[model samples]
Target chain A: MSSQSVVFIGAGNVATHLAKGFYQAGVDILQIINRHFDKAKNLADQVDAQPADDLNSLMKDADVYVVAVQDDAVQNIVKDLSLPRGTLVHTSGTVPLSQLSNAAPESGVFYPLQTFRADQELDLTQAPICLEASSSETYQQLKALASTISNQIHPVDSEQRKTIHIAAVFLNNFTNHMLACAEELLSKHNMDFDLLRPLLEETWQKVRHHKPSDVQTGPAMRNDRQVITEHLDRLKNEPELQAVYRVLTESIQRKYS
Target chain B: MSSQSVVFIGAGNVATHLAKGFYQAGVDILQIINRHFDKAKNLADQVDAQPADDLNSLMKDADVYVVAVQDDAVQNIVKDLSLPRGTLVHTSGTVPLSQLSNAAPESGVFYPLQTFRADQELDLTQAPICLEASSSETYQQLKALASTISNQIHPVDSEQRKTIHIAAVFLNNFTNHMLACAEELLSKHNMDFDLLRPLLEETWQKVRHHKPSDVQTGPAMRNDRQVITEHLDRLKNEPELQAVYRVLTESIQRKYS
Candidate 1:
């Protein structure tokens, strides 16, 4: 495959991470476009790419236009953008691919299945790529492109991608919040949060090898009314946490029963 | 400097994890007692201790009797048991140290800061030890025992421990629950849950060196109403998750604001 020029249209965390990942993978970023001129400059400078805030200027020679923006803005960005026909894709979990259906050089999704934080570095090799295209030929090109950066590639459609994102929230966001809650409670009691780190890490590790429902522990899963009541009483003021407690406890019990 | 014989009351997660940690640190486990004889025997076998179903049998010749029972039963167990004064402790975060005051043996708390599942191997070296004792000498003994297992020890009274427990909820249970919620939402759309693992891991990793409020990420932290709304609407039927979304979004906002 010949080296194709890639264009990044966002300068946010995901954009920056993906830009860097692509740069490392030998994809010559033709240009980086952002609403904010300085943001586009910063990202372009980091990746040694041409910085162009106006989409029209970069669209002249862009082989691929990657719309790496917020979920709500994907359709509008794709619709209003003046990119070449059949040459646009949006990196969104929930947004449909049809938004880029308008003539683009070759539209496709190169969704990186990993979280991005500006301060953290990413290994694109391990990051799964959820690739999709409007047609079979484009799909092959996108798959080839994704394979350049990552070995873990999935040719998933929008619906499947959305489902994966939903699961991610439960496993990542909700789990992290629960960890935060546990930390909050333990810290208030003058107990060290680090104390629970072992058990917490083990909780996830067990689920990695064993089925989650099989390895469920803690008061809720055990149906220990005594501990649950005590913890709930402590969380009485935090209505959100109490509701969480009830739902999770019920879920755990239901899974076991 | 001399090793004293020890009697462990209860064979639950806490007791099992603690006893194994203590035994590794060279404590002599003389007896183990639980409501269920088989459970006690199982735990005792692992720790190389004799298992007994009755109080008198387990208590005989025991230098220290650690009560590791449920919170509600703490008082009852203390009152009904006739252990000789000057060596009793309960491993509870909520129960006051005074609950063991009426008991013959002096009382204190040797709380291990971690969640425990029966199958998970607990690494106490990093586990925080929250300790309080009836006397200075007792405190020294408990401190020595804890030091054998972990270096991170906090001399917390029951009141302080309560605050610590509250903090624990934030760091542990609540954070984990939040992760679960996000996973739930992503799964609804057929998204792979693995996408969030790196993000979740990074969240915890960041806090090891940084403040939670400083390192906050996500739609809530960014104040991205669009993403939040889409996420919430996606979780429309999940009242608990929706409530969590509302509460956590507000909390993160206030925290950063």
Candidate 2:
């Protein structure tokens, strides 16, 4: 709607969401390029944009170039990109904004700090979009572009963004593994995994408003050795789970102690 | 309303919620008893029931006696209680139902599977109320009392209930600690913890429907050594967080590998 045409360099989950978000915001999606032509075409078709597998014939007149590839692939893709005049951005939490300096005169970061699933539809309007740029002008441009989809825009540097990324690993990856462990334990006992849902729901409800440490309850937090020991004995058959249980118990105990 | 009178044996978080829930379901709460008379009276005031600090005048005519005490205290409380009639049930996940056998002729387990906070208002209507009893008559009584508040009732033995309790530690306690870790990391960097809420929201949304292992995304899941190493290096100053990060990362890597 603002006459700022954009091209996405990857058609992954992040790119798919961003492209659809932009398209719905009335921005002209110039192209969608991926290493796999099918993937590019698949996403581009939804956004009503051209699809290209090769980087050689990239759109030269776009207002912005979004490099949404994997963190490892971003450097090579940006290095090889030959944009005549457009601000380049990478939607990554870890990668620095400077990585796109060679791709365009203007570079920035537009990281939406949420886990994306290829099959699941995510409304990005409320997700925190952490931004960093090489210049003030580029920052403003990136901010304006991000405003189209999300209002939770934050200006974070590379170091701070890396910290957030690491924190996210703890919040998302590790917490999810904990749930997986619960599922495995329940399934082994022939108990319904669905039985754990209300507890899970209540836990997150508390998490939304209270500090995890303040609301923390369990044998570990209470330092109940009897319960802790009994739980350890129950998990003795699964050494891997026992190790995880022991470490987490020790960590919680140490934190509170 | 069904002429089944109830008496609560503790005024802790579990007792507070259960007592209130039963009162709302039109069940008669004859007395609320706790070691602390003030705590007992505080909850009794809400349900229009009598409060007592001692077990000397426990209502013998009440159809159900609910022991909502700590794991270690259950045996002693049940041992000391002089009940003339009615089913005696303990709301504990770890304590075996047999512990109540000496307290009453009709003994049963009426454990509500949830982490209760005294301040929070919880709807027990959907939470799993696990039941185990010495006789079919006791089971039916507990089930009817449980059904007055919750539709989710399960008949689980001590061993299975213990397994669920252990699993709950992983799901709620450890998972909450992970969020605490994230809060600490973010706070040290002067970042608002609220920024992490959307990610937390989306993570739980995915968790509600999918197997956690399937929806997992992070360096550990992918075994991205570079990112993992970078993150570990960042946590060099915080040894506790570093240990947790390393253990969780290794666990995820081992799980996938």
Estimate, for each residue in B92-161, the C-alpha lDDT of model 1 and write its tens digit. Answer: 8888888888775677899876777777676778677889999989999888878877878878877677
lDDT of every predicted structure (CA atoms): 0.71, 0.89
lDDT of 2 by residue, A80-199 (tens): 776779898998878877778877878889999988878888888988999999899888888888889998999999999999999999999999999988988898889877899999
Runs in model 1 deviating more than 4 A are: A72-76, A103-105, A179-212, A236-257, B35-39, B45-48, B72-76, B178-200, B237-257
lDDT string, candidate 1, A16-95, tens digits: 98888778878888789998999999999999898877766765676677889988778767666555443677788777
Point to the candidate with the largest DockQ.
2
Candidate 2 residues lying further than 4 Å off, grouped into runs, are none
TM-score, candidate number 2: 0.95
CA shift of B149, model 2, Å: 1.4
Each candidate's fnat: 0.41, 0.86
Report the lDDT of model 1 for residue A86.
36
The count of backbone overlaps in candidate 1 is: 108
